[model samples]
Target: MATDTLNANVLVLNKLWQVVDICSVRRAICLLYLRHAQVVVKEGGAFYTFGFEDWKDFSRNSRGDDFISTINYRLKVPKAIILMLYDRLPPRRVKFTRKNIYLRDNNTCQYCGRKLRTDQLNIDHVIPLSRGGKNTWENVVCSCISCNMRKGNKTLKEAGMRLIRKPRKPDWKTFVKNRFNTSEWESWKDFLDVAYWNVELEEDK
Candidate 1:
């Protein structure tokens, strides 16, 4: 049971309390003991020391031994941790791919403005490659199979088709924000960027 709890997922944060990445509870505990990180107490909203002597003051039943147990001492588990050394936000670079194009277009057909699943969507080159368009982010967008077939190889003007929205490359922030549901990550919610939540991570030092 202790080992299982130690293996649980832990959300890691930068010194500024930004969600940087996730780690195993075991790793989080190690960092706590090593003083590489301190646990953030969400209850009273405080950052608490995780030193060995400090943890020993608390009873096992009060805190829990799964987080730490050695000799006659034990301590509490950390659901979230903040590193002492990191400062900068992680770097983000949006990739060029079919899945990313769907994300950029909000999984909706740009021509008709209807949201659809992956299977129901098609990647259409804004300017067909047959003419002179390259397979670039700006040149492609999400379209339904119907729109793709109707437009065929003709340009929008030629096919009498019009785009409901302009297709553009997704920035790293917006790209990652739309990837998760609004209510899906409660534990990670506060630590994530409020206005622009992206989970891109970089090395601490």
Candidate 2:
């Protein structure tokens, strides 16, 4: 029970209250103890912030399975925390990787348009590497094993195949939504709005 409580997921927000990352309960507690973060509690459609000592007091009367017991007291495992100083997210880019490619394409074959399990999918080079195609977002797409085999090392015209859609770099907002859509943590949904986090920076004129 103790181990499970410490390893439970805690949604982390920046000082601006924008969803930033997901961390372990242990990390969240450490941050709280160090005065680097505060636990966020929601009640009656409003959110409240609590410091370590305050949170300890808040947990005293709380009865639930989601808590850790120490020698002196029990601490409720916090569902979310806000970093006291972290106000900016690092510059964002959807990572170029096979898994991201599958996500961008929705795990559906570009040529045959069949959605397949990961085991049945392959990352295909639209213009084969043998033909000097670079491994890039616009060059690679998800393909089923059958379509991959059928289009092996051949140009679309040569293989008598055409793509359903042209692959492009995925939008950052879409990528964030798809990557961090935490359905299990209902509290997180209130903070994961793209409009909140994706505010465009005003440029100096």
Candidate 3:
């Protein structure tokens, strides 16, 4: 009887696009059952779940137990399932490049903070690569072509240039948007705010 009970509660993950639960080890027994199982939440730290349904319905015509029951007898709450609520970590921060730095800085030259279009931007290494600075998020920024040329292979101090703002990693929301192209991710946007994305940095500071 215990084994039967466990089996009845088991839920599985399905591959079909209409399916919602991705981490479940068991599948809904039938299409009707699948449809009836409400999407409780999206799996991840990100609060992507919205417009989900709950598990109750009533016949419109009857109020005093006159309605016919449509629910299946064997259907049970999903068990052995760890529903993913949100992304556990923020999306990875990409290494800064000329193009990305421009986007992050809104096409503004970091040295002077003057906005420019794509053609006028150049990638500048905060610490010259010759001095063992790795190509990474912290060490790159966008500059105008003239500024970049004047600062070539020289430290900021050497070139007499100063950053208008410190270059740091972007938050998870931006990172995810940059990395993946899908409407599916739109549901999670509200949860990935600047505060949530910068949680780790806040802790470190």
Candidate 4:
């Protein structure tokens, strides 16, 4: 139970009360202890903030399962916290990776347009490497084994194949939208944009 509480997700807000990121409960408590962040709590439709000691005092009378027992007291695990200094969202750049490529392509074969599981997809070079094709966002796409073998080392023209959509660099918002986890804390809904609340997360390779 203690381990579960420590590892639970905690929503992080900027000074401006905007959603910034999600952190672990352990990190949140550490920030609170160091005076770098304050717990943000909601009660009676109003939001409130508390420092580490004040939160500990309040927890004395609180009753819930989300508590960590210390030698002298039990600390309530906060669901959200606000950074005392940070007011900016994280950088908006999306890393180019195999998982992201699959995400961008919706796990569908660019050549055959059939959606498949990750194991069934391969990153195919639109233009073969032997022909001087560079590995880049616009040059690679998800392909099923059959389509990959069919288009092997051949240009689209030679293979009589065409992509369903033209590949381009995806914006950060598009990528983040796909990564939002629907199971995030309910307290986070007050800070998160409506568009982000219902999204799902994908595991990175």
Candidate 5:
């Protein structure tokens, strides 16, 4: 189980310590071998690391479970890695898609402000396509089944509907808030400031 945990996903950090992406254990080990990145060992974890010398002794090492051996080399699966030269920040724009639309709306119907399950939600065009509305982020919203049926082929004013909020492209923070999972990214918490629903904070009282 420990070895499986060791083989779990690894977080990749840029030179500035900002999380840029994730990588597999095999890829992390390759980066370490190529000297492009360094493994990060959490505090109180004995400070072990994967490096060029970890490849020696092949089968003679007693701690084989900590590493993957490739005939002539062996190195521990990386938990997290820091790129030595990757300094660019992540792109500002997020991809546009149905899932993104739901995220932008927080899975709530824009018309009635009702929260519903994903399966019960539908995508609505703020300005009907037949009436000249383009399918861009600024013109689309998450709608409930009832609202969608109620507003079919009609404008909001025409259908006697009001929007809780206007549709617009979400900012980078909001995009990330909807996209990332903190549980799977525990190794990245120290480097990122994203506040997830599952995070625990000190009691104010």
Candidate 6:
């Protein structure tokens, strides 16, 4: 059996709010005002208490309205830590992949404002790679297969097409979505916004 005394980080909660991160169960009991209750085991020696029950007991027995209550606790391991990690940096250059091009142009066709699916999309270089344009995020946008096929190896001007919007490097939030794990993003949504993401590009000028 796994040792119950293993030191693990825990999320201390009170009803709907997350109160704190506790390094150990003992610390959570003492420092977070949880009671030392017990649960009966079939072997009759080992026992445990519901963390929530302990908090309720502590709150009821306390002298004043300053009672504390914890709703739940979840063990925090390396996987949990990984899921919570977030970075606030932007990518140096955008890749010439379908996802990056779609994200860079907000899933809209560069020649038209209509939305397109991943399989239905194509990456188009604004300046045409054949004509000194590099395959960078700032120079790529999503295009329909027809637009891509028609514009092959030629500048938009040469293809007699105009862009609905100029392609530019996305800010940090878009960059993060393009590269980071989805689980890591939940904790970061509150800190990142569309404007915060676009601000860095604005400052580049």
TM-score for candidate 5, residues paired by index: 0.57
Poorly placed runs, candidate 4 (over 4 Å) = 43-45, 61-63, 102-121, 124-147, 150-181, 185-187, 194-205
Candidate structures ordered by TM-score, highest first = 2, 4, 1, 5, 3, 6
- Residue-level lDDT for 45 in candidate 2: 82
Clashes of 3: 13
Top-lDDT structure, candidate number:
2
Clashes of each: 0, 0, 13, 0, 1, 1
Q: Best by TM-score, which number?
A: 2
Model 4 clashing residue pairs (backbone): none
For model 5, the run of ten residues with the poorest summed lDDT? 196-205
Q: Which model is ahead, 4 or 6, in terms of lDDT? A: 4
62-90 per-residue lDDT for model 1 (tens digits): 73334556576666666677888987774
lDDT of every predicted structure (CA atoms): 0.71, 0.82, 0.50, 0.81, 0.71, 0.50
Please report, as a residue range, the 10-residue window in candidate 6 with the lowest summed lDDT: 76-85
Local accuracy of candidate 2 as per-residue lDDT tens digits, 5-111: 78878888889887778899999999999999999998898899999999999999788777888888888989899999999864455678889888888889999
List TM-scores for all candidates, in order. Answer: 0.57, 0.68, 0.45, 0.59, 0.57, 0.45
lDDT (10s digit) by residue, model 6, range 121-168: 877778877789976657777888888888898887788998887776
Tens-digit lDDT track of model 3 for 1-205: 1333333322222222121222321342233244533323344653121111222221232244211233442222332222233223322344444566666676789998788888888788899898989777778888998999999999989999899999877654564455433543463344344353443321111
In model 2, which range of ten residues has the least summed lDDT?
196-205
Off by over 4 Å in 1: 1-19, 22-91, 184-205
Off by over 4 Å in 2: 103-121, 125-139, 153-177, 180-185, 194-205
Following a full C-alpha superposition, what root-mean-square deviation does model 1 have from the true structure? 6.7
> Candidate 2: deviation at residue 17, Å?
2.5
